[model samples]
Target: MAPMGIRLSPLGLAVFCLLGLGVLYHLYSGFLAGRLALFVLGDQAERAGPGGPDAAPGSLPEGTVDLRELLAVSVLAAVKGGEEVKRVRESNALNEKAKGKTREGAEEKMTSGDVLSNRKMFYLLKDAFPSVQINTEEHIDAPDKEAISWDRSIPEDIKKIIQPKKVPAESVTVWIDPLDATQEYTEDLRQYVTTMVCVAVNGEPVIGVIHKPFSAYTVWAMVNGGSNVKARSSYNEKTPRIIVSRSHAGKVEQVARQTFGNKTVIIPAGGAGYKVLALLEVSDKKQEKADVYIHVTYIKKWDICAGNAVLKALGGHMTTLTGEEISYTGSDGNDGGLLASINVNHKALVDKLPDLEKASHK
Candidate 1:
């Protein structure tokens, strides 16, 4: 023997080592399989109802994602996208990064985060509803012609929500704003940043979702369908609370003074969607919610579509100060200065501010 300690031959040692490695590999594989099983089984509720193996008879259609599923997907995409943007902003090199511009001449303020998030949502939606037309704020592409992937884990219950009749892609459209308050986002006003998505069929909004990334709250609805999330707001205050733009406070106070009088409390906020949410948000034990959201300057359609949908679902109203319904799908800019309120005082408030449309021209 070479030595007393080296009793076993090299072949024996090699065999022992191989056996140990095999055992380790087997344990690792088992762990991975267990994890995969957990992930697949965790969302049981999502897979329940008419789509599961025990699905209700005749509950499904040819193929589609319903309005409720669309709203849920929108919130999911927005929150995930907002998280990416937040991470990018947290980096020390945010301002040093270059920004892209849209066709409208406004700084696009797109980061890798935005592109990635937009693509992620697009793919997710496209996979769920292969024949639907979808559009986004970052890029102007012919949505009807875009390609889609077959990979998706969407539940059958979601697909059954689509109408039994197939709608052509050209007739339906979905608008997405991966990050709504790009300016406020760059300025570190995290609360103002939101991810928005709207679905319009034949130039009308059927569903909308607005998600506040930093706050992690989502407001979404189908047109005139009761809001899935209820927000308790006490509208008992003597003086009305008004929400105005933080970036452009031009003539807002003057308008408020003329419209609601000197007693009204004005709250400055960024992002049109957030301003609308402020109307429903109650602070502390008391209620300090806004009674109205008034903006005289022109705003993009993506900024208010989700807000309008949610407000409408709550029996609230958002219309031009001149009291006209704002149409979606055909245009990007909304020239009609908006007046939104959750209370029944919409007509009363509109009557109070009769000159807003004329004032906007000035």
Candidate 2:
């Protein structure tokens, strides 16, 4: 009974297109820069820093990894992340129902829809995707970060390293383990938070979806550009044309304005997927630079998923700060900074970009 694919109205389609190719997926699934997909799965990827599966192959003393083991670890990570957010969501709901609009808490609060969406998220991840599976251990001590799930799309070698529990994914191949920043979500913020999974066999994704267990809506897509299960988002559109971080607003806002002009509009703060999607929104205007996603910081796999799929489907591209092609099943982006270039040429950006380390850090 949940919607089965990505659906968009003419207006929604235009909004999605402006968001990013990832936001418009169904054409193809990819990871996003911030995802421009809707929300970032890497709600707290920055906290995880760069280790575990994210480690460069050669950087490891072994210079190799077992896929199964990697999957297990990632699954563990995803589960912890999920649980933490769940707790936050429920607590926020209870607190809000008591306060009833006279609340002063700045945390974005959940709506009735978020509660229902949690059920749907477990359904798709557990039942829909054919190539992915989820295993939850109640007593499992989640890491400091939280939200954990296993991924098997990686090659056998990586699987061998992780020693993951091999199981059949649902009809959809992608497994999105979304953890929208609970802090932001509970604050009743306009931007959504989520992580997504997109399965591309021979370079085509038949599956795409986003799960927002903390908001009134859970937006996702499947097959082709059908906006199934649309999540509630910013309709008020004070339209300042600015981008703020759900978790790190002050820092990201400072740097974002440095790149985008001071006059840029500010979208309500949300997760990376939301940010990526927000970046896409700017493209609707005439500034070609809106398409360009500049990474002065780091990123991760959970951060990219559905966003990546949406953009690639629409002929857009995401790269590293170095302008290297980003790999989803290959590496976690936080290790290498990310850069998204819309219709514009990013090679020029890479060529001209000053070292943030030298300039910003200075």
Candidate 3:
């Protein structure tokens, strides 16, 4: 035999070619499917990189940390603070002291509850996000070096709602009211007490977390990111019920009466956070439901920023008496008087209001 020669018929060659083509098509289809899956998942590549999801909390440089992570940290801090509030209240050791006088000449007080909660919340956030600016209601010189423990996990529902993005530390600000309604807390009005945290990006509140220590309830929202609480479907626009501060009710009641008529039901409550929750209709008690929240005279940003973010997330608006959006960057005080509403025409309500100053005089 000279040399064995291998030969294939035309049909055999065609079959071989078809088999090769099928293999290539399968490989190509698999590659394309993977790319499509990554695209739909949103920022999966970013999360896999440094300072991403795999990185430990506080391991990344300031501002490089993911916003979703920051939001989760803030939620943890708020709940931790709420726990402190409840602990101190149950101990019956408020040790309340007068902090100073409010702009309206009312005595502003601080207590052990405020200090402990503030320390807990501030350190928790600062440890997780070292460079982000944090503004807390209480001022304490001591550092909490007790090795705070918190679960860095974000809730699946929350993660589903918030998109992935990294915000620079310089552009982010965290406001913490460790113990809102301390006065009410001292008065045994535990329902009004709340621990709140707000994350403002570029001077606008984008994330809000409010926790009621007494009831162990928490409601949070991130702008464009979803809220745990649902907005009220119905609003009483005509003769609308309004929620005002029980502590600062005089001026707001007068203004609300002048604007919405004397028949307007003015529900007096404590704490800005509580009043805002009422606007969202997330009240434990039925009487706390209201159409709008009105405040006259000065208010602090920490007192209302969380509420503002919550309102904005729900497609509502919170602004000045003259319908101006409040800025959270520079001064902490809002002197324009506060007007917040959901489900109703906020502008229409603002337009009806008389001058706050003139109304106060009357």
Candidate 4:
């Protein structure tokens, strides 16, 4: 009465177990492949959200792009550009020419170093993040082929400070000054020369890299993400050593003297990058170190964006002479003049300056 069930042979039971195992293995493999696809094609996958695959790269929801990866790529681009700058200088093949006139009617020079470095940096950045906006100093057609390969490795020091974070790709703007001190470079003042890169999100610079090719020195920072360099501990606020452009020092010198008094010690220097480095106490020469950098004339975003990011990382400020924060969104030139200070009261410094326009005319 209890024995109505038919029993399977041992061989049949073994085959049944093998078939079940095969099904499980297939499912496991499928799961892994899905994850791999997400990792490899993250940008495209994220972009293909509710808007479909044709959606703009920045149209994806905010906080979807990894900023850390962008920072690493920027550092690589800057260092590579620095290498190119050094090479052109060493070869004595600048082929320097007056590219155009600045806002103040000074002859703005462009050299082989600028063109070569711009090509090197631009291609690297564009290849890595095609969606991000890049503003370089020079305008050149994209090459038929990219010679530089992308490097994804982040610097060890940078890795220690920055954490995983994301921003909208559309909100990111990269500013590149392939050769910051071209005039200084032509004058054989290699110490002032630098290759710089900056990452500005929503018009706020969040990352900066300044590489001095001659010295093989690099300092980088991410705003609120820490920096490899430290802010200068001691500031001569009493005498307040001020750094101004050697070529365009006349107006700033007059302003510095008027604001900080005749004893303010106006140190004429070349390169916005160098002046910012001076404020950070990154120079070996004592004279290069300063309390503030003043430029009472027109300036470019590419020239100061990296330095601005670095200063912001160190709890400093760079703004217009009127104490208004400069915007890097629309135009390349900032005619409000520049007022930058590190570990010092920026507003207080701005308050001391006489009317720059009146002072300049006088």
Candidate 5:
């Protein structure tokens, strides 16, 4: 016992550290071994050709990390590299659309440089939150290109829910702007700005953001639920409010009356983004401590992705009316309809909806 006082000296400590480093190196080596093939071939290399130098046709050693996790991380990294590509496309598209909005002025278009500024806003998001990936495959592309213009002439309300993404996998989708309201931005039409971004978390938009750049705002909500429906001035339990389309004057009026009652102080504005902003402003207002906001209508994916991020950051949710999670796996990039709410728990929407459905049926 007396001899054991300092048996383990600095040499022993050094040896322990060496063993720890050795264990770490082994783990690192295993991970690298599993990913070597992926790096050379890419995610879809198996379909590239019969066999390549990098292709591994055998099993991995035991204790190796799961390939699926590696795949997810790899895909995520590649997608990030391409985010700026999306920004460039958005900039060019919006710049082209801005000319359209200018003509719509009275109406008023965003400045020629506004498109670039808007692109920067997206960059801000990427820089600020590295974890939240930007997947813009919200049906912005069209098969024939000719189909693109055709989709635009359709009713605004109708186009809002039309799916546009080419679902690449259970987790991947291609977003196409069949019609991203060029007439509004081109002609300076304030309320005409609209586009959708389909989102998927393992192929779903647990949340979405719908932006109306001309209005300089956006609408966000989770895909599986609603927000707390609180106002800026008071979190007081007042009548639920619905943010409707401003450009579609008639529909907006109808929705306002139907959802908030004839006496409801209509939160009038332009773009779906405006509607969501109104709710958020009210929620943030010191006068209120409210819990949620609600959007009751159709909106495509691109229109909601960014805003969904914001709403989610602020503790809100957006979802479909059927109590299903908002998903971007649809062939086109749109869902039939979406129901957004603030602060309201997702379960509450389910628990309370059946009774509302029954009452409506009556």
Candidate 6:
């Protein structure tokens, strides 16, 4: 150390100073490069520096509970947007003479709540969490659309079981249904209207939220974060109550009737989301709860993702009629049909699918 301090000539000293500065700069840049952060405000989002990992496509940190809370707020805004439409529809501002006459007239009849909510939800998500991959039933055509990165905050237990080898090299993707049960919403079946948001990590539904604007009830769940409302099954009775679609019952009613017989009461409700919730909802008058939810028709992933998440979180089951689990990031259409119930043993209903097919063919 004494020799190093005393032995430098002019040229050597100059070279050493330059080298030291170079090393310091390299260290500083290395430390600060990836730590750049973003700050967002109402309609004003700003980036402090340009070196976030999100700058790289399909790379993001794991999501956390904060993301779930953000998702909940975003979904609630969608529900509020739908409420706005319902409010206007009930206000009598539009003349009753032109209800459901033409395509434009029909759109005007419902007040564009679905599209409006879809737009708001997609845009708000973009502004707040810029790195998430988003898929929606309604396509948004914003020019500056950018998919950002997300540092997923997965549950520890789930993360342990999910092999790192199985996770795809992509950011988390969220599927959104701004408004579920459009037909029921238009028909003023307010109870059936729901806004849904689902987050799929590695093609799995890890987080889901179902919001009902009319009832001001919201249910959400994560892999480890249980639902706000715990699901209680009313399945002890010999005869179980079942729910089917009011608009698209299809072979479900026929197969259900064949399997459960006349003693089983099949409650017809609108919206797959609403039907799922009915399993938990106690009837106002009769105080009865649904025991099973069956839908043996083609449905979309967005329609069932939130409900499925809620049901699974409540220790219930939601799967294809063929006893297959619904894949969130797979095909948009669920072709095999769906069967969901809380507290009821799934094996009984799952075993009946073959008999249902046989009976339907007859």
Q: Which candidate, 3 or 5, has the higher lDDT?
A: 3
Q: Which order, best to worst by lDDT?
A: 3, 4, 1, 6, 2, 5
Q: Using TM-score as the measure, what is the rank order of every candidate, best first?
A: 3, 4, 1, 6, 2, 5
Task: Supply the TM-score for candidate 4.
Answer: 0.81
RMSD per model, one decimal: 12.9, 25.2, 7.1, 6.8, 16.2, 11.4
lDDT of 5 at 205: 43
Q: Which run of 10 residues does model 3 get worst, by summed lDDT? A: 353-362
lDDT of 1 by residue, 173-284 (tens): 7777777777777777777777888877677776777776666666666664445455455663346777877744555677667765688778888788778777775232
lDDT of 3 by residue, 1-362 (tens): 79989899999999999999999999999999999998866676566665665555555654465677777888888899898889988999999899899877889999889998999898888877778899888885765443675567777877788866677788888999999998899998998899999999999999999998888788989898788898988998888888888976776777677766889888889899998888775756633788988888788999999999999999999998888999989988888888899988888888888676454333
Instruction: Identify the candidate with maximal lDDT.
Output: 3
Candidate achieving the largest TM-score: 3
Across 205-264, the per-residue lDDT of candidate 5 in tens digits comes to 433444443333334333334322322443322455444434433433454356546764
lDDT winner between 2 and 4, please give it.
Answer: 4
For all candidates in order, the CA lDDT equals 0.67, 0.42, 0.84, 0.83, 0.40, 0.63
TM-scores of the candidates are: 0.70, 0.44, 0.83, 0.81, 0.40, 0.66
Better of 2 and 3 by TM-score: 3
* Candidate 6 lDDT tens digits, 163-234: 222122254677788777676666766777778888777666766777776766666666656555666634
Per-residue lDDT over 1-362 for candidate 2, one digit per residue giving the tens place of the 0 to 100 score: 97799767999988767778655574455544446534543644443334344543322222233223333333333343444455655565424332122122344444332333343344434432323433221112224222323343444433432222222223213334445443455564523555344443323433333444334333333333333222222322111344444333444455546655576444445565655554443322211223344444554454565555545544455666566665544333345555654455557656655453233232
Single out the weakest 10-residue window by summed lDDT for candidate 2.
Answer: 230-239
Candidate 5 to native Cα RMSD, angstroms: 16.2
Q: Which ten residues in a row have the lowest lDDT in candidate 5?
A: 144-153
Q: Candidate 4: where is the Cα deviation over 4 Å?
A: 1-63, 283-287, 357-362
Better candidate by TM-score, 2 or 5: 2
